[model samples]
Target chain A: MDNHELFIQGSRVPDRGPDGDLMTLNMGPQHPSTHGVLRLELLTDGEEVASIRPHIGYLHRCFEKHCEKLTPPQIVPYTDRMDYLASMNNNLGFAVACERMLGLQVPEKVEYLRVVVAELNRIASHLVAIGTCGLDLGALTPYFFCFRDREMILDFFEEICGARLLYNYIWVGGLSHDFPEGMDDKILRFCDYFEARIDNELNPLLSFNKIFIGRNAGIGVVSAEQAWAFGLSGPSLRGSGVAFDLRRDDPYSIYDRFQWKVCVGEGLVGQLGDSWDRYWVKVLEMKESLSIIRQALAARPKDGDVREAVPGRVKLPVGELYCRTETPRGELGYYIVSGGGNLPERVKVRAPAFSNLCIIDEISRGALISDVVAILGSLDIVLGEIDR
Target chain B: MEFAELLGHIRAALPGAVLEEHPEAFSPWILVARAQLPALALLLRDDPALDFAQLMCLSGTHLPASASESDRLASIFHLFSPRHRHKLGVKVVLDSADPACPSVAGVWPTADWHEREAYDLLGIVYEGHPDLRRILCPDDWEGHPLRKDYVTPATYNGMPLD
Candidate 1:
């Protein structure tokens, strides 16, 4: 069957009249704006998109199947590969799930350290989101500025754990290693510098750019009802004016202790849940993450063992649990079923981007072909999680 | 309301729908017959007191061969109510011989790709899924990989495996 028949099965295809101007366009298994190997088949009449079908699985490495083979602790590195930008949060979600199953209580220091690293990773992930989003549109300078600030966060990550990109730092019960000497000072310094830059430099340059606002604002608006029905979470859901944040509403770990605002899109420049609203939410969230980091740093205990509760082997009892955490993109849930064995019977990942990406077909219809990239970048999907 | 109270309300609404309840399980779940899923899902979403609008996750599993029942394949739906701030798990056991269950895509549009993914990996068919093609694996690939009895083939096209 052809692409149209495959998507709109049993529906009659519209005729193109005498000019015959309708065409099907493939937007990337390789295009830079897609953020990874995502192929969007667009049915277009000239410049307007009639319908869009997203073809994924180019990066499917069988993550869930791999989890069934590996032990709980060994699966940390694999979770890193899902949403690589938010690896720490992914590790924390899996670690929290395993810890719940094993009934292990980690030290106070582990909790503080987890919050610190996860908040930092949240900033880093948003940097990539805002940066690439600017690039997806015509603005290029913001990408460089955003990446430059993001490098400092990566430097802190590299100092704490040996790996920069994918750190298996968060073990089942505790952490892989405690912070290195003077690392706390470095993190605080970076937070101070990063906050200033985000407010002064990044916002003025890209977030408030008239051209950027014109290109993004009032485009691809998802109503709160549609967003909730589609199961869009995190910034995407909040962008549509839903105030649910897993960190606050769900309240797992030490998130309740921090004083941070849940930023919801208010249609400041355009309609609520538009492309610009989603972009602005990320910008505002960076500041909220900084506040969370500061609180975590202040509350961190100086003298405590990070690896005190790290078990030699993680053997879960006969049970199952679905644990979810607020990652940068949305809610990353790990539905783990154990058969009283070291290896999980099944590990189903409810990837945020997977659900977030599915709404593209619904939203992209009737939009100009150029706004497609803007809408996609605003969603800030990492195909790693989508295809995993 | 507590999970037990929620289950009680469901029992009142749809009699004989819930086959069993496992309150002691880690997450606490209810098993529903395959025929009762669509009705239960509708009641779960539309009923204001038990509004489970969000279908958080849907997973397909292959039961171990040693299990007593011939209905070995299962699909689990994890539902959450953003309004009520409650969660529920609805499970349906399908016979391995003919692994099929009524699709809840009509109740929750988010289940479209998820049911497709479940059908792709574990071979549990969602009876009314609009497009039930393979999601992660190639469309023409043989056998569901996540089933307990599945064996890796030695070769694919010209590729060889040890």
Candidate 2:
């Protein structure tokens, strides 16, 4: 089978238009749809993308190198900068790795509260993903609706931990601050409101829009076998009809207690593993995040010291620990090698976006240039994490 | 399969390649011969009983020379099986003089970028990588930045860094 037939069963554009002259097109380092400094060197035969070679590292900060120089606790802020959209998730992954290395168990209240904030951030991150994905397809209305709803999450994050964008609230031993008084009730209200907004306003406005569906459906299809081979996780894996979730499968933190469905894509408006399937998976995941947030809020203990287990000085055991948490995008893992010192011997971040971004060349081989943008938007990569 | 069973299976498959196994650690890790990395990786992916299909993370670290051991560069691959819900770590420690690892990019296509990133930062050469060019760093950049003794370049292209 040719590349076009491999992607879709009855693809109309089977022939590459009689082997047209190949043209090289550079998309982004600044393009809005490429999403944050990611440049794709697209080899195009007329409009169909012959292949895509993505050039990353415009945001490389050497996070692991910096981790070696700093103490374990000091590394939390650096983790925050990675995947800046899901900073709390990054903080939680690193904190879990450090706590595991130190053999530190946090309080019940801390566990409950950590779940709350992490889930909240998940919704916030997904809101940006769905919103920008809409904008990529030229739907102006949902972009505003998403940002307007997302501001509520940003406000809640700011109240909990002073920063709106990059909150390093989840510390290694425990949280940096208490779950703000009455904050739980406010998030509950937002959850109820956002659930309705997704169904009534955003869904009709962007997701089912005919032009948007036409653009995304059957575009840049990635098969399940290819997804596993490419090492995709999070929504990217789930989008391909795989029921692999670290929260469900791996059971990290207090996630096992909460009852939330892992929303694998069901080909709501397109072929299985199409760009539309991937995009819709993120939308369905927001509902699951809401369920998790509500459950975490209800089950959270009335009171306990948030920072009860905070160490004065750090002395970690000499061992390697690989801890992975389910971030909004995918599995955020921290592979830490501690050497019985204040500083870590090696800190390697298994960034979700880094792997998710690598699949472009595979799927974009026979897609239109515009479909490449839609497919990339569906992958939902944050270059901050990719280049870290 | 348990750690011992998997280790036994791997040992049976490639007896010469299996160096050591850490059963008591946080995760089941195996230290493998550097040259046998591709074979080990292929087995880990293809063997139905030990199906570790995903290369979740690939990291490279530089270890300073100690009293007992010489300077070495280590490449660690974290593998996971979605079907089995299990995890295993494979590590290869390269000699300091010529740090080269046979690329597992063929086993896991995702390892292509990971190996390039490792090559970019730590200078552990992935010998069989199709494109082993520096990924995070520019082609003109000198000296691997993640090595223990690496010094920050004061200037690049006549522009002062500090």
Candidate 3:
């Protein structure tokens, strides 16, 4: 069937009984699409969902309490565990928080290198988000194509650092180690190959496909006003036609030097703020991140120091600070209250998943059960970030 | 918004409570009486000029005074304004004798889980939260560990609370 004809069809909602009533169902604390230990109690009137209550905290690791006992430098590694899909971006946030707290200035070369690695990590994260989003929509082939390029990024990560998934590469003052031998070429090659791969395989396989587009085009919709009310950041907010990217609005690093497009939701080409718009926004964002990565690499400085003198252990000032950054999902904010000692007085993480997931109870009020999974997938929630 | 002006706006809305404003950071911190939190939250949310509609985060912390056996706990509310691109922080001090405060779930539904989290971890009860069950920790878990004077327990439900 054509894409438009396919879009005209609705999800498979089971018919009610003689009295004409539906049943409620719990999807997870173990389902795939809720994405890691999330239990969504779905109230359904047949296969059509009446409401959804997301029960999180199955993976609550007490990360905030752990931050209380550790020093500023000690907390950088913990950010990795929150959203493991994009570890470098998490590391950058911790480093920026510590930098702002202590007023530490990194060198120009360090800034350029941080930008390159962070943008690369952004691309890697978007690949996973888009790939899995497509997988949730039943396009299984794109996962292989997306992960194939993602493996190249992981190879570059392993080359520079020792780990694949959780690279604690970005330290408090600067990077853990400078770029290894011929590291720049591998990254450049990955970027050059990424665009053509997305165009040929990933994009057409999902965004342009009839079934894929129909499943997601108008399934789950969130308006710009609702997006702001829910405190969404990153691509989830951008997917709702809001132009509020922290990278551009609140430039923490060398984002000012690079020029890239902020891909906002264009209504899924057929429906605005639908699941398809949310999914396609990330795919387009990956392309934009590649442009940023290219610019950051082109203006690279070779002979500058990547390390600075950060105190091994120091007490923070006796006060509180709330710092936020744009992560792969949305706004990941850290609210730390320091007691002017080795440990934080209290550390609270305003995770993106927690905020983004709040809107689910509103948006999924009348969606189909299958579309609820599609909508949850489109939100791109990580349970670690949600339950932290 | 200027830190003093923001505090002044909040103070004007709720006249009975004392307001504390600090200028060290761009975001100002407001100190309101524990009893006035719900009203203050409503005022902040309903006021058109300072329509801080979004509750970004709600967290509880330990007050660092050396007084033993005293209830020295503090709760902070972080509010965000998307229209103005600004943020304001509201905090209240609760004592051990009666560590209770009003809930903001009535104003913003997003505060429901956050308030329950605070109640679970810090033992600061939100008087008006509908379903105030343990959010992150076990339902039968005892003692708020996030408090400064919390005693470390060896075991809970036959497993180490570690």
Candidate 4:
């Protein structure tokens, strides 16, 4: 062999081997279930798994650095891309972080409006989670059903905000623009239609079906103790018997005025907290979210400023703060550090999918390969959040 | 709990680290010395009175404009205790010279990935992390991009960072 070939071989770089004991498989940089550009290296023992190492950062667009470069208003649009499925929630999160630091109090009307829009975003996000979960488990019918409902919600979002998927509608102090004319009536009608259809059509077809139950129930079992240790939050944690919902337990954005149940599983068809338990938690969460929307709509505020009367230039003080909210996936937290400037010095997002995805290595080790798909599907990971 | 109460609790636990309380906000924050971070975190995790067991979020932030080295490079850990339904925020400062802190992966295995992301993007090395390597950036990528003074290179795979 040539000297160059000898030198390259001397370096212990990993390569595909025909008879290797540990075969490495790339899950996705584009695979459907990854939710985004996440690629996981799965080391398996023929068919059974030995180790699952996540290789992330394919979509790391240096958002935190970019946030430092732009004015606060300019940065609002970028938050849309972070957790794209729940962009409104991401928008609210970034706005609240800045608002809290600045000690700005939003109007009551704005609060109620925020709750309505945020709840709609939450339901829309959960639909994607549930519909996509169904898709991963070899069911195609539910995707169309859930998306059909999702499209209706998106139509409402479009009427209120110009954009549908990545709506940067919620701005600092208040919404980018107040709900357009007749936005309230449209949202109310959508909520009523959603609430009725959930029980009649969506629940029976997706959550209550015998086939879905058999596929998800008793699979990807993560005990309550394990869930807490691994920092599982939102529906995944609630499903594991922890009645902690940030909207209820830790009220933010006028959530204290609303009443809702933190859904936990009694394991109707399985043990304490399996994939089915988590799956059902999302279903119940959507119902609770609809209730929240209804209440917020009823208590609409008459007159107040939606936008805060702050300096035209927005800047955070030279301090650090961590603000979190319950997203459809779990707890979505944003940690921001400012050096008393127009742009934040540092911004770190504690995405729920990252923590939720981490537990896969611990739980999926012993489950069958087919069951791994179910476990991952039930975990409801959005790779955009995971990779970011 | 109130901000003063959280400050008092943290003060009682870690006598070495400096504490700052912001009464304006609903929650209080504590700034611990970089050297005493792991011990302080251990105390918060182990002490029943301040059992901040759930590491809700561990993140890194750059403060390049801050005058003091104590504030320039910071890694914050937000802990939540479901048992008590209380939250605590902890911060540690790292200097630009060597941005390394003890790995909390031992305390929470999930920190394994979070710390790597911090190391990869912010250049804050979490020492003793079992699998400490570039997570979000390619192994050959130069310079941490999250630093305040970072200049985005021309292109990554022909797409400009801008």
Candidate 5:
């Protein structure tokens, strides 16, 4: 068969042969299962996929170009737009990178508050991951259930930052606002309520369903070696049983102080690196995030100025820093280069979804077309992050 | 192994390959010649004493317009050795007149898209890349947008832009 034809058409079927059964299909850019504007070019030999190419850039906003012109503090809002689901985590990553560049030490209360909101955002982000994976697998009930819990987190975020999806709440040195009166108690209550509901209601309804397991288990398995080589991070890598979480392995902020377990896939329903394991990893991580939220709430500083270290006009000396934070997806790294100016010389975002999405063509090579969706869903890519 | 010792080992392994060392930078980096990157990457990954197994991030940077052509573009590689729990930064500078460097995608598959992204945004060619197509921008897009001297077009596909 002609490799040239396959590259252009993404099909293995011979162009001149009448008996060839290979077909090429386009999956997204508008499809619901894609979760965003992602187009998957699929080459299928009947039901089994021969090859797949993911076409992105539908959401590219030239964020890096925009950052070069903006001041250090101005870039915080742009970071929020990349991974819209976990804006708090994105803001925190940029904030910490700038803070480290300037050698600014934030207040103790700021660190604890950052962790509290970041972990809360992690739970919200993972809820979307779990809920969408269920929806992609033809189970609709869990999506609503997951969203119901996620809405409560968003409500708390709204109460704190006044925005639901893209809150530019995290400034360079501190937060945009302190937690309002009695907000910590509300977060504590939500944590308690979320833990009970996830354990009692959501787990049995979706995670433990035999149909869900049968659909996801052993589908699109990525070996530990391939996962590392392809730079898979966050839950997808953990699902391969690598036991690497930046929060624990590369301790940043106050995560080292929190008491929580890094959840790795045990292959409960399938091979350790299968799609099911990846999905299950996200499910277990929500519980760990709750545990962290509980601990952070209990030990949070009672009174301190969250913005004490925040300078009115932020400036940086000539220097460079690379800071990686554990986002809901995986390791979100910001490499900032300053040329002794108010604006960064260069800002490069090492988006986890970009690396995670790169592995799609590698693992989806021999799997069936249906398994392609299962694998893509399990990867849990946000196009905002990938395209940015 | 600590970062200094890791650099010491690399320096010993490949003499003259370590061009410059910034030990005091926020993320201490070592500049290597572009031609030596692939070998250095292989050594960093395979050497047990300095097993930088994972390529954490690859960023392409363009020097200011005032800089000469010989120092126009650079690629930064942030590597992490999970076994040692240590990190190192490797930088390779290239001349913009012929901004090309040996591809490390064969050594680390993750570098495939990253190199492509660097090539896409900064016009730095990753020589020997499997398929060096545009990643974030369209295949038919005109100029590298991230370059220091890039000028935005007023129209793309006849769409007006102010």
Candidate 6:
């Protein structure tokens, strides 16, 4: 298939064509671009990959098994480990589900703090995604620039929450600690610096670079029907021209209060819903997250006890709840069932990476071996989140 | 639609499919008969009024033997319709001794992985699953670990738990 034909139409080459001369190549349990211990079995015809099967669970900690033993409050730490890149968003999702089970709502300050930290983490996570994607496709400098900005976000996180990587800061009912002195100004400064940095620093380095766009645009195309049928969410779903953001549609937390646009791929430089569109959506989402952070900072209450309504003891009613929030990667859902006890009966996590990664075999059928790396990088699957 | 209105719509379309409805629960849900699940799932997706374009999550829950009933395993499918922006929770209860439910992987592409995960963790055998191998756990792992009566093995493949 020609590049022009493939760009207009999604990859649909035969599974075992080209005289049936196929060779199998195993990709990674430790390869650099596989992201985190994910292994792929590739069926290749010459240099093009005809089929791909993903094997995960190298990072399996059986988080749901762990949650079965821990209480609603105690499971917060485990949630952080699922998607370590976006620990605040992970903690916020589990806490929201547990709070719904107990029917608890925190003060307005707590809500604002949650939104601020989560949005900041979204920017940090997307930086890693965009940076590593460039690195995988042979660009070296953008990765360094991406990590440099990410370091500042981590510093802000360390300032607010003692732990840098896994905060465990967001509790079931409220935050573990309120914002410390002078925290608002520091976050706003970082936000101001990042808003300008994206266009000047990121766009030229990777976003609009000729080689980068050539490698990504129209490589792994996912149609709108295929996107939602396969349960793709977050940026992956939006990349296919689907404007479904849970924060906007479902109205969770304080997201409805904010005024921000959902970034959908417009085929600006390539065919809509291609790998470039997916990568571009993450870049645009970083700016939207900054807008949210600034709005949340101004609207937040100056004086309020974040921990005033923190649950002292645990008592779950005999019922179940399924709550989902739009995490940086996608929709992170928690289906918690309580049998009138302190501990949960069942806790099933619907990790977005698991579903997003499942669509790999579908899109990578006709892609070349080199294109596979860019495709996987576009999907941005975290093995920890997938295997959990 | 409100929970009751949706429930009524479902009941009218597919009579004798729903076994129970809980509007008072934290998230209103309807218990569907095990045999009717495949049809019910297809209807939920194809029906324009109940256009559930996405199967958000499919979870397996093991309920141990209680005074009310014996050990039962339930497969819960959370459906979301982007068109209507409505949510529905459909559950199917199975016997823990022989937990088997027809797979809906053909209906919703996402169910392919989810059914495997549920089967791996809870041993809920999906009848028509294309590939039902263990997902998170090893293929030869002796028993389902999520069961209430699960006993962790001391060693596996000569590797000690310690």
Position B19, candidate 2: lDDT:
86
TM-score of 1: 0.96
Candidate 3, residue B60: Cα displacement in angstroms equals 1.5
TM-score (chain A) of candidate 5? Answer: 0.94
Off by over 4 Å in 3: A1-14, B25-27, B67-69, B160-162
lDDT of 2 by residue, A254-274 (tens): 889988898888777778898
lDDT of 1 by residue, A1-388 (tens): 2432233222224444568577899999999889999999999876678899889889988898888799988899999999999999999999998888888898999999999999999999999999999999988999999999889899999999988999999999899999999988888888888889988999899988877887787778999888877879999999998898999999888899999999999998778899989999999999999999889988899998898889998998889898899999999999998999879999999999999988898898877777899999999999899889
Q: Please give the TM-score that candidate 6 achieves against the real structure.
A: 0.96
The true-versus-predicted C-alpha distance at residue A286 of model 5, in Å, is 1.0
Evaluate residue B79 in candidate 6 and report its C-alpha lDDT on the 0 to 100 scale. 91
lDDT (Cα, tens digit) per residue for candidate 5, span B69-153: 3448989999988888888999998888889988999999999999999999999899999999999898889999999889999
Candidate 5 lDDT over residue span A1-388, tens digit each? 2333233245323343356477899999999888899999998777667788889899999999999999988888899999999999999998888888777888889999999999899999999999999899899999998999899999999999899999998898888899999998898888888889987988899988877777677778888888888889999999999999989988878888988889998888777899989998998898898888888888988898888888898887798888999898999999989899888889999999999999998888867777788898999999999998
If both were scored by DockQ, which would come out higher, candidate 2 or candidate 3?
Answer: 2
Runs in model 2 deviating more than 4 A are A1-19
Better of 1 and 4 by DockQ: 1
Residue-level lDDT of model 4, residues A1-388, one tens digit each, is 2443344234324443567677677788788777777776777766666678877778877677777678777888888887788988888888887888888887788888888888898899989888988898778998888999999889888887778999888888887667777787888888888888888987888887766777777777888878887888888888888888888887778888888888997787777788889988888889999888888888987566677653477778877778898888888888877778787766778898889988888887745556677788888877677766
**Residue-wise lDDT of candidate 3 within A163-188, one digit each (tens)?**
89888888877888888878888788
- Please tell me how candidate 1 rates in CAPRI terms: high
lDDT of 2 by residue, B1-162 (tens): 778888888989998898888988876689999878888888999999988988888899898899999899999999988777778889999996899999999989989999998898899999889999988888889999989989999999999998
Candidate scoring better on DockQ of 3 and 5? 5
Among all windows of 10 consecutive residues in model 6 chain A, the one with the lowest summed lDDT is A5-14
Look at candidate 6 and tell me the lDDT of residue A154. Answer: 94
Candidate-wise lDDT, in order: 0.90, 0.87, 0.79, 0.79, 0.88, 0.90
TM-score for each candidate, following the candidate numbering:
0.96, 0.96, 0.94, 0.90, 0.95, 0.96
What is the TM-score of candidate 2? 0.96
Across all candidates, the chain A TM-score values are: 0.95, 0.95, 0.96, 0.91, 0.94, 0.95
Off by over 4 Å in 1: A1-21
Candidate maximizing lDDT: 6
Error of 2 at B126 (Å): 0.7
The window of 10 residues in a row where model 1 chain A has the poorest summed lDDT is A3-12
